[model samples]
Target: MEWVFWGLAAFCAGLVWFLLKIATTIWRKPLQVKKFSEAQGISGPPYRLFSGNSTDITRMTDEQNSKPMALSHDILPRVLPHLHQWSKSYGQDFIFWFGPNVRLVVPHPEIIKEILSTKFGNYPKPPTDPLARQLLGKGLVDLKGEKWAQHRKIINPAFHMDRLKGIIPTIVRSGANMLDGWSKLILLGASEIDVQKEFNDLTANVISRTAFGSSFTEGKHIFEMQTKQMILAVDSFRSVYIPGFRFLPTTKSRQRWNVEKEIRRSLRQIIDARERTAITEKSGRYGDDLLGFMMSESKEQRRVNVKSNGSLSTEEIIDECKTFYFAGHESTSVLLTWSLIYVTRNEKPETKPFNGNGFKWKLALRNGRLQGETRFTHRNAKRCCSVAFLPMKLGRLSIPAGTQLEIPILAIHHDPALWGNDANDFNSGRFNEGIAKAAKHPMAFMPFGAGPTICVGQNFAALETKSVLAMILQKFSFVTSPSYTHAPLLLPNLKPQYGAQLIFCME
Candidate 1:
């Protein structure tokens, strides 16, 4: 009986010791990081225990997004209220906690350049979380080191300027198809159309045809599943990063898992079919599409050395395909939508054909450029998950090792000091002088990212945008619908809350 009592006492003491260790880790780690940040003269809103500054961020974001605001080009506050507020208080370089994880906001162009252009070994993509891994997979965006090098080499040929230029007609054809639908709707006396959805469909179709060598219908299911999964994944990001949160059988978790499974299944089917066709078919039409280029390159890699170090497996290829679709589709659609919104607000509609000669056509393209300049509608140029193991000189300070940094793109874009007092205004003329002189820093205008790892499909996206917009401008004149609201929703990207409602005067 004395032995049993002693055993119980020992067990209790051991449990207490274990709890203390956990408490020490949870409490000391963040404080240590915070102390390091403060030592380097960085400060932000004080963090709370365990939750850190997440509650405050959520409160600020929810408050800003709850109400509608006036239609204005200065939307930095609406889209990123927490970052904007903190920037006002803490200046360009400040510290914030992503749920106890310390992150430094390095908005200064010099620092951004250092982060992006430095050796990949020193500053790799920040360690991807489980949620990100589940959604994005280990694609080029998430990969690092030799695997990244290999993927980039293989994917480079597919996005060559010549290859992208060849797809111009397909973009025009896709745009024309959407316009045809709009015409039929107009005949049925439909005067109003949500151009947001229209553009989304158009871009998705463009990606489907260009990347997969398949029409939109053939791959629409994959897009649908991915879109749903992305939304859930974005929502999950805001939650506290507790270990094992993803493995729980919660409704959201289960749904995300199911959706991801479906996406992978669909992508596998598409890849399998393409591989079979490549083997069986004699036509060189396969060379015309991105999938063909990738597959061909991958096959050649295998032929040279079956144990080649750089070659990607079938699963990796599928991840890359999904990455292309997600990156290509939503961003281009947002760009087109915002372009139309800005034009409707700033310029008068033209009834005549816009063949690059019409006043409104030129005006539209200029506004498109401005829209790209001011909007953080797509992936910001922040080096994701990148860290320094040893102290590195960043501007005035030696940034501490293990410091996670993100370039505050939205903050810099709207900074009056950099872009002048009229930075907030919708001035396409600013870019007329070209991007070189648009801002104080040459790297200020990074709509398509910058540095060595800049977007591979930027040229393709640009040509596609130009062709589609030119075709649309030639067919219709449009104004913002009466019901249009100026609420910019940030679902991991800046977008309209009620959609881009437009009254199209189709001719």
Candidate 2:
């Protein structure tokens, strides 16, 4: 009994000591970061224990999101209130806490260029949120170093311009299918449709067909799982990263874990089945298409490399598939949705637009680059200034090792000094003169990203977006629905909180 009592006391003391150590580590790390930021003269919002500046950020975000805004494209303030306030207060180069992590917000193009290009290796992609990782997988987006290099090499064939062109018919068919649904719905009169949903489904179907060589019906479960997991993951980013928190049996955690597990299981079965039946001979043409490309690459890499750690595993291939779905589907859909909304609202009667039949419309679209504005930037996490200053110099500022940096795209995009007075307006004509004349700096407009690590699927995304928009434009003329609210909220991805409701009429 005495031994038992002593054991209990010892256990309690050890637990207390362990917790104290963790607490100390957490408290000291951020302070150390803060001290480094201050020494570098990087000012930011005041820091709080554990939560850091996120509480204030959350408060501001909540307050901003709680209210609806008038129909306008200037959504930077509403979407990122903290960044807006900090930009005004501390100027461009400022530090801020994203939960417990200290982030130096670099809005200047020169500094941004240095971080993204000049010091490319120094500013690797920041660690994704654990919850987000669960959903997104350790695919190319999540990986870095040698593994990333290998994955990029293997995946390159899949997104080649030639291969992308092959998928154009699939894209057109998917868009037409969506328009068919809309046609039936709006048969009576002009229909108030959620263009966001329409584009999402369209993009999803397109990606499904393109990636898997199978229709949406086959990959619907995987799509659904990812979509649900993404919602939960986005919510998790609002708080600090707690070690082993994801392992806890909390409802959200459990849901995420279950979804992740199901996604893996479903993908495994699909892959296994795909492996069994092969219509194409394995002559190393990336199997047949995109899905085949990924699967073939993974297998061929394993067979040849054998011992190399660079080659992706079976699980890794599954992850890449998940990443492809979201990466391919989500961004394109958002661009299309925004394009439709803006075109409807900003339709100019003055400009002698292509007023002709479907064939003429197709000819015009095919002849020129689709002129549309995509101001919104979708970055998972801002870059962390964690890299050590090798020779002790980044521009005029001396950045210390372990310091974090965040490149606020929203702030840079809407800067009146950079984009001029009409920066907030949805002006697609800004790009008519080319990117050189678009903004003060070319890096100022980074919708797809900048530097060497710019989005690999950018061409694919652009082509897909143009195709969808062209189909929609050819079919109908759209205007923002009266019920549409211009509340651009950030659920990690910038989206219309109330949905992009648009009224479409057959042209």
Candidate 3:
């Protein structure tokens, strides 16, 4: 018995030492590596071996807040200090390391335009983690190459101007319903409202009605699961990306797998039910909601395949349906939320409204809505409208073929040089004349992105935003509340860090 006890103690000691060694190695490995320096006209920090700026990126907010700065000045730095500082130190075209990978920060409008247009195919999407892929599925946002092309081809017609106009009533009706709910909440005298959540619900409803031809209450289960999966996927990124990290039988991985299974099962049920109903009815009465269009397209594709010896598999159709549901929902919600924040911050009070002439001039100047008078020199440039696109030649830079270039839309919209001193100011009047005259560069105001891969649901999103905002504006006045945090953080999409708190007084 004494010999056995001694052997067990020895085994435990050895295990402790082995675990300690592994921990030490992980701690010592560098998270980022800077390949070049700002002094050399290369962007970002010098890459550390393994971590590649991960430590600084993670602790950015804490560090930025330790110093004194204006709220606006500190906003971007607190969230993405590396990108901000690097953009300043290195000229517009520079590269930075992000955890053993180089991310080229293309800040110039011309460079951005080139990436979005001329050299589009050169930069494919970066590889998403297996967990992310599982959660998001191979949606249009996640797809690349031939797969993406196929998705674009099949779904493009659904977003055509005519098809979109058919869905306007759906957007308007949904917006009206949302406004009625808000009215009831206001009547209860709620002091502060979280506009972010309001928009989420409103957009969710819009997506459900417009995409699924059903109420959000019906699709709430699927949306909830997707939301959970997104949160888990983002959290899982903290773990080291070891070889086959995804395949490892870890608790988090297993949880994600289970969540994904649930999502897939739920989605399959919805698709199956819709197909069965379509089959039994004989008449197509669902109209142009996203699912209806997709079903119609699938049927056509099937017929074609039968005639031509090939057709899209049911699995492919299901995947596309899932993609539309996710993308169509999330992107529209984010855009509407941000647009609301912008309009609220910029709108002058009713008492302080500018005179008609002044208002017209301001609107024209802000958005470049007025026609003609397009010529201008760099130095003598008056405040042109805030929205404009310009064409320029961008010299070539080394971009790996498969690199997924992220066009930081928010960053571009808020760029100082392009938008003058008050670039960060939220002024919708900047879009008065439309985006064309807003900036010296035409590509500056790409809210829905530009080029071929621009969001397919842009019109639908716009109609939803316009309808909701119009309804809200007609009913209540919105102003930023004291409880509102100014932090605009990106959790896959840009959102208010602490939620958008606003006061709603009856109009």
Candidate 4:
């Protein structure tokens, strides 16, 4: 009885000590909420201990889909509705607590520019959630300071206009191949198609061809693993606000780890084969694909580093490759998908001009394609050309250190003040004329983002999108299917929550 009592007391003591250590470690970590609130000039209710405002944030996010359907204008309303409401109640720059942390939302374009361009170094990507960082590895999107600078310098030449132009034929070929596949399906009596899935496959193939200089069939397994990884990665983002959750041996974490491992293994094999071929054949001239270009550039850097006593390790190269796969695949696909949706939704038939607008119609469709057609409505004539000056002008917006600024691009693009009353409506006709002639604020439309970090594959993406759309439009007329829902969600990038479904009719 005495021995039993002593053992029980010892166990309790050990447990208490463990708990105290954990509590102390957590309490000592710097709180993120106070600084964030001060910078944004707004405050919310006091945070709950341990949980902070995590419960409220989670509840708000879950209820987001319940909001009444509205025109898909901006993602801000959907992605952060709680923040949107708080902004209205407080101010444009408001601070919202998420768990134990607070994020300052800055909506003004001037402030956005300062954060993105001027003081970029101050706000690094928050340490990625452990699971996500493990899966994604540190790439340009996640890199900061000197690491980011080094990667950017080495990779910059790969995106030069000349290098991009060399891949145009590859882009066109991929689009044509996908279109051919769609035609086969249409012949087999499939009128309704999942355009989102089709676009995904198209982009996947394009990336594989342009990045690997090999058939997508060869890279099919890699694409498959990446697709799974993307879903898992997105899921991790939703749940990541919960502190220490990633370290647990949860099923989600295990799955993510496995997927990441597979992707890395496949990439390593591809890299090894390429290196061997370069060594044995063609006297080490690298292939012209994006991956090949990256390897070639990395090798040059490695040579320089060896001569100068500074070198990046093999792990760093692998991290970069992973980054390329994620960034290159996802962004281009989303942009192309959105562009297609815009074109399909907004395409209007050529119409005869109303009395005095005869010249407008003549200029609108030259050589059976939409070209430069500028018109000056009585209200917009003076402001039309003035729009061109916006991007170059630096407006007054003070930015403090360590502020993470987001370009509320969709908000800017769809704002009634910037784009007139019909801003929410899709109207590519607005761009048929030079953008400067059509936009009330030329800086507002930033599908490719802006400044030095704008997408490297913008031209390739545009050409591919045009080629695919042209081929599809020539053969089929499309209408929205019943299964289509307009619930836009943000997974870092905006996407339709449900797949885009459309009915296709053979022309």
Instruction: Give the clashing residue pairs of candidate 1, or none.
Output: 125-385, 126-384, 126-385, 126-386
lDDT of candidate 3 over 461-503, digit per residue (tens)? 6666566656666666676676766765656555566777777
Model 4, global lDDT: 0.59
TM-score of each candidate?
A: 0.87, 0.84, 0.77, 0.75
Best by TM-score: 1
Per-residue accuracy of model 4 over 277-361 as CA lDDT, tens digit each: 8898966756787777787888888788876523345566667666666666655566555544444444431231112111222
Displacement of residue 368 (Cα, Å) in model 3 is 15
| Cα lDDT tens digits for candidate 1, 163-254 | 78878878888888899999888889896899888988899888888876653465676777877998888777767667788678899999
Q: Per-residue lDDT tens digits of candidate 2, residues 200-254?
A: 8888887787777762465776887788888887767655667887678989878
Q: Give per-candidate clash totals.
A: 4, 4, 33, 0
> How large an RMSD does model 3 have?
10.1
- Give the C-alpha lDDT of model 2: 0.71
- TM-score: the better of candidates 2 and 3: 2
Q: Give Cα distance to truth, residue 248, candidate 4, Å.
A: 4.7
Winner on TM-score between 1 and 3 is 1
